[model samples]
Target: MSEPEEDLQEEQRDSTKKKKKKEKRSGKKKKQKEEREQEEAQQQVDEEEEERSECVVLRGIFKLGKKSHDVLLTRTRLTWIPITPETPTGEPCVLQPGVVLTAGRVRGEGEAAASGRPAVGGAVLGVALFCCRRRGRRLEEDTLHLHNASAEHTQTWYNTLKELLAGFSSRPRYLKVFINPSSHKKEAVHIYREHVAPLFKMADIRIDITVTERKGHALSVMKECKLDEYDGVVCVGGDGSVAELCHALVLRAQLDADSPEKPVKPVLPLGIIPAGSTDVVSCSVHGVRDPVTATLHIVLGHLQQVDMCSFLSQGQLVRFGFSAMFGFGGRSLARAEKKRWMPSSRRREYALVKTLARLRPEDCQLSFQPAKTSTGNLFEHRDEDQDVKQDPESEGEESWTTNQGLYLSISIMSIPCLSPHAPRGLAPNTSLANGSAALIAVGNTSRSEFIKHLKRYSSSSGQFSFSFVETHAVSAVRIRPSSLINWSEEESEEEGDSKTTPIIQSEGAAFPWNIDGELVEIANEVLVRVHPRLITLYGEEVDEAESTVSCSCI
Candidate 1:
């Protein structure tokens, strides 16, 4: 072999080996880049999946009992993720806004209490009454405590939980309030600031308060209210305030419905802080006048629709009444109003005695349309058309019944009429939101009989079973004094001109109407119609079984 050929072949072999090495290095780099891209893509996918989780607003280590776990706090819930136990993470405990009553810091315990400095021990966060169902039909309450965090952080969690809880049941950023300073006890404004404002501040809610100076001031405020800027309306007073607010709001809704430039709006949800002579509406809705419970109910944004009785005369709405009583009850209320300015604690007793002394059965001409009670759900609300369809035969049928002699009292109640005055409620069988109102037409009876019937209300036995009283579930009622109507003239002629005495009195003698604890002017001819679910109140919704005893309040 020649020396030149050997050198060229050696050079060719060296260049080929270098080319192979370069190819191998390029392939290795490409593989590395592909693997890096794949890992990045997988990371992106994992983050996207986590986004679907109840996004962790706040997370930390929570010490529950002796065990510790990682925890997450959301707007409406708190979740625990255990770390050391080596157990599969399962469905987290849901702290429902409605069920979770309160969140606060726990007082020092054991060694922490023994120590002079509470900060030496870690802080604790506690939440009360986390209601859970074990057998699907029973309610179980549990309290949760999170320990081992710093004092400031624990407080922060508490405040955050409160803020989140407030946000859970409601989306109201601002509220419009009407406070009647002259109502019953006249502490409405004070009650509102003390009990209501703090919760609102914690919940980050803005309050626009109006202290009513005059009798009809609240009505005017509600009528001219700027509906867009408010989340809901709150009334701080008694039943009178509720009546005023409801009337104004319903009228506004009607006006908006008739307007061409604006859309008709739903009546804003309303909350009542009981601070009046009688707070039947509040008791019926909240089960109690507990300031904290009422405030929390409003903050949580719970709502229960209720029926309303609208009093109309001459084709115009005069007022909206949650409860009404005629005869001696009305007379008693009227007499009480006149004596209210006396300033004596015995004024009510004096008025009651005086009214009862001269009380007699009222001779009234009554006409009504019977409500459909076949479904056994007299408390359920139904539209007019639906009601008619359900009882087609009774649609246009009207029943006229006359109590020509006397009636001790006739109470028309939309709700159960639960109040401190009437503990078991005025109309115990009636549903608050049902389309029907109970007409408890109590006929004339002796004082002793009336007393027995009234005493029955204090117990759970009920007052309707008495022989002197009769009740009818009615959708609407038209009432006029038989002594003033043509029926009176017909009866007078039949009795002949020999006995010239009138039955009741002249048509000008207007009997006062006791409307929601307030005495109001009522004409001789008054028609009351029940508007089903006319107003929505901040309260809880119990099932039919629970509805009857929903208000165990004083």
Candidate 2:
């Protein structure tokens, strides 16, 4: 073969190899571009899926005010879009966001139709939607009306909305209500009828109400009534009424379980409507002592589990309470209970003044088991090592710390007991369902100093900043008064014998203890044990409470 022919063939082979490499590179680039586009499309679909609406129940056209609008209903929300006049039959011009459905209502007829007024824009059928509108910490009712020419569409929308609302499992369907007509100015019945009852009706919750006629009437009713028929229990009264209900519910649960040693959580949630002189539980739970706010919380099915304290005296269950006070508080309440003929406000003021005038310390022995998890104590005047001590009696068990002193007042609270007089709560360091209680001991101080400590509760902070005040987060506490000593019998020896024995009596001497605003006289030592998340209350958890109008009595 010729050298020129071989070189030409080689050049041809080189050209063919270069052309094949170029084609291969071009195919690779094209495939990479297609893969990128597919990935982008998949990502877009995933984003849309994340933002997708819940199952759509109904969709149609309705007249809102003077213009036509497109409405969409789903399991979670109710959305509406405005239709421009130029695009009457086309898609909506503006797509507005939907309103989340809470405790709302839907009716087949609108206000205009009910009032015999002509429908706006000459529409025939109408539907009204009543929804909850939140304004800061308050909730208000709002209504939206939609008019359509087709009755079948309006009726379908109403039915679909009703079914969706009914599907919410958290909201209560039936409630057993107890109204203490004698609670605080004798207006509990009126408050329930005027403010709370209407809201319950609006939410379509069935209620069986019992107007309490006496002090222990509600407790008796709670003991005998069948709680299984109701979804929740509601009390309309002061803290005393609420405390009664809490005790009754817990006692009933223990009895039903046949385990008095191990108490179980109540089967139902409790709702409080503030119609009392001092609505501490309501204020502490709802952040405000407003009846409407509490009612709205119940209607919305907001659940907050709270810790409760079981008070046992001499190995017998005294009661279940959220907060308790001994020493000065108990004495003041004892005085106030004796003055029932006076008006409630006047009686409280008189009690406060009289108690302050005769402020004396009680010699008592305090023992408590500190919580395992350290919830930092508020205004701790001593070091942690000094506060905790090993119990010699229980060698390997939990250590128990004992303190014996003359204390002006001893307070134990599982929840922040917010009230008009004490906006920061009697125990400001405590929280709901923390498995611990705030044990505050105010050591014996001067009258001025004690008054200053008491008045600081109305302020924001520094209520526990006093040197004499000490706070601890404890799981259990035992309080025994050292002053409960009485001489029962004394025997005189014969002439010249000169021998006499004195008999010390411990029983039959009852001391007043202010427990959840109810005065209970208990004998012997009281053991308070905290149960974590023992009961469910209808309200949201609050970290802080805003101050209300302070009382002038203090």
Candidate 3:
């Protein structure tokens, strides 16, 4: 804490940063060198190389650093040809969407321009055009000043430049956004005010904001709201609100379709901004929990189709989301939901302790058909391969595996459930829209062993290595509680002529069903069906090799 010590620590931190920067620079240089060598050996160009040979719309001198270049804006990429008599225009410096940072028009002061420079300044006087180009990890501003140009010519070139940049997106100018005020941390409004609104304004994206006042408010709004007026639906809240909006949107789309047999679903993408305690869906998709980055993705108009799982009880749709859980996972969420009014920091701990103390696994019968990828060591036992043959109802694709046992938890995750509780994600290998859901059945085990397994979730360790844990990639699953059913009978001999009825009550607790962190009614049986690519989201598809690093906006 002394001044000298503080100075030393600060100097050390700065030195470390410098070293990291130097290492990154060296790595980038090496990669570039290898890339150039490979290209030369193969005599091949990049994918968009041929596109640059098309008609050059605009051409002029532009300044990059101290040097000038004759730039050409083609249909696909930008080419900067250095103006020099000695050196040939060897692969004209090419730039696509990835390297171009900020592309806009410049005004005021004039900069000296040589023939090699592209027209940077485009409007009225000076170099009328400017763009920040990426140099390794950093961005460098490059301006072009037209040495001699008329006002009309400048305006024309600027418009053309804008058009070129706009080609990256489908050009969605308008969108409808819903903000849930009572969601996790109560910061959706503040998040929008501080980050989302400003970036959206700059992008020239018109957003109609609606701050929700009550629960189930978004559901009603989506039911009655116009579907074709905007480019996409933006939900800013926790998993509950986002899931609610999705449910309502999907229902409405089906309702409004002309043909009930085969409905025409809406292709409107949904954008999720994480402004809640648990943004599992958003985090799972984007690989981060930042609100601005999510908003930018919407503005960039990235499209991804997401799978949806519909939970139905007695043929009526209860709810639908990307993920759901039964038994202990459900009970734990229910206990947690009670203390949602408290701070997220305290609520999680409170929920965990309270739920564990009263935790009791319920005996239930599960019937599910295994997905193609689920036939592994776990299915080696094959308890009910004969059960499938005996049951006439479960014919063809309905190869149900019936099992009865006390289970701690049964989790059905369509998307990877990522949160502080499960940092590496609950179902880490679950696909985003792979036409399947991961069914994890945690059999009854000792409290200490269960806690030990739970602790492993916080780290990148083997949480599924427990002997009691079993997982299957299933397309459809049905859970039937052994002791959840109820029966009532009326006595024939009543007092005088009146008939009396007696209600039969079960002594045990029912396993709570958790659907997107919200509890459904205590039902004896529940059915889940996966719908592949049911709705489009403003995120990329779940690639098999999804990188942990921040993905570039493509």
Candidate 4:
């Protein structure tokens, strides 16, 4: 190597170096392109996974938009369903759980691929989101919202459906429904077959309907019903029927006093459906007289406890429930059996008017334990001051005058409202389970005084006003026709009503008693006590609507 040879060699070496560097840079660029493509493919796979995660199975209903449709709850039968969402819309859509659809109509897979989302799927999902757009997104377990719908509407639908679903989560409840066709208005059979049966079917309530044939039919049913076989006994009749049924239940032991030993019994829950002309029990308990309304209350499953009372006559059961009377009214009630053929409207107009017009004082000895002795017992208050003021001045204030004849109306009741006609019913302070019975005894007086006494019974003033009267709460009572006495006789002796041979009062005597509304001619004179938590009732307590009165003077 000469100088010229060295320059040419150096140039060749430079050229070779430049060629190697270019080859190295090209290899590195190719490697980077391959890595970027691989990264894009991996991202595409993850996006597909996220889309798949959105599909969910959701069961729901949607109201038809002015469209009447037949829904097949069972694949075989078509039910004409209401278009409104409130009426179990019956439009059930089973969506993939946790799938959130967008606010656009469902089209083809092309739009889904183009947008890289779930715009369409199976036939079911397609029908559900037909008018709206949908995509695969996580569906929340707590709430499933339909796209493009009103938010408030969606929430309302969800809550109702949730409750409906919750109701079905449990097994069906069997209920024994008792209907008295002879009760007030007498629509028991119709109510049971139409209103009550359908709802019970919807709610899966097993039912056994009994049509009462006579006045005491309901009482006999209550006495013989296998209470443990059912969750509750529902009465679809008037208050009188319910009273009869309840009375019979409460007096089970008393009715069987002559038997060996009282048999152990299971307590049954009582349900009421207002179907009678005077649906006092329904009005008092549920505050509504509609059978459907009452059935809804039963479905809600609320229970309450109410007190019961019994009336006894010399070793025989007469009547029970709230009211027990000894007066012209009692005689009238006994005669009401003859007027059963009269229509409810006629009976209502006639029963009260006739009883009032034909009223006559019947001499009787009415007595009960003082209110002070047994707090819950039916007692009487002798207004000495009022008695003295009303006494004739010529009588010279006879303190313990041997005998006097008079007409009287005795009423013993727990709740104030005796019938639906009297909504003000007993005072608001009254309690159905308070173990107290109010007694209103009206004694004989002048015709003007008798009318005034009747007015007092219905007066807004809760206190009784009378000359020879007593008003108090008691647990037990006794009544017998007074012995006939001659005013001409100088001396008076206790003379029994030998003509009728009235049963005499004595310890451990079985008396005819009436419990609830059914009159048992032989409810043996037996002990009657409150059984706490025995009667499981539904809706408002009887005492919740009592009238307020001032007892400060007591």
How many backbone overlaps does candidate 4 show? 65
Worst 10 residues of 3 by lDDT: 106-115
- Number of the predicted model whose TM-score against the real structure is largest: 2
State each model's CA lDDT, in order: 0.64, 0.77, 0.66, 0.48
lDDT of 1: 0.64
**TM-score of model 4 (CA atoms):** 0.54
Best by lDDT: 2
Q: Residue by residue across 1-554, what tens digits does model 3's lDDT show?
A: 99999999999999999999999999999999999999886664643454444567777764444455676666544556656534365645443211222222112121111112224454454234433332221123344443434555556656676666566544457888999987776888899999778757655678887788888888898888887888889999998888998888888787787543332346678899988877888877666677755775676565677778888777777777888888666766766667767777677677677656555565667777777665542433332212333234474675677766667778888887776456567887677877788888877776777787777766445888887787788888888776662311221232132111111236554446778877765555788888887888876433222223232110
Sorted by lDDT (best first), the order is 2, 3, 1, 4
The root-mean-square deviation over C-alpha atoms between each candidate and the true structure, in angstroms, is 19.2, 11.8, 18.9, 25.8
Query: Residue by residue across 487-549, what tens digits does model 4's lDDT show?
Result: 211112353323222223434322222334333333232323222233456545543222223
* Counted clashes in each candidate structure: 2, 0, 19, 65
Model 2: per-residue lDDT, tens digit, 347-445?
988989887766667767788888777565666574232233455644365777887766788899999898767777788778888889999988777
Off-target runs (Cα >4 Å) in candidate 3 are: 1-55, 64-69, 79-98, 101-153, 165-171, 258-264, 372-391, 485-511, 541-554
lDDT of 1 at 328: 69
lDDT (Cα) of model 4: 0.48
Question: What TM-score would every model get versus the actual structure?
Answer: 0.67, 0.80, 0.72, 0.54
Off by over 4 Å in 4: 1-172, 215-225, 248-266, 316-320, 370-407, 426-429, 456-459, 462-469, 483-534, 542-554
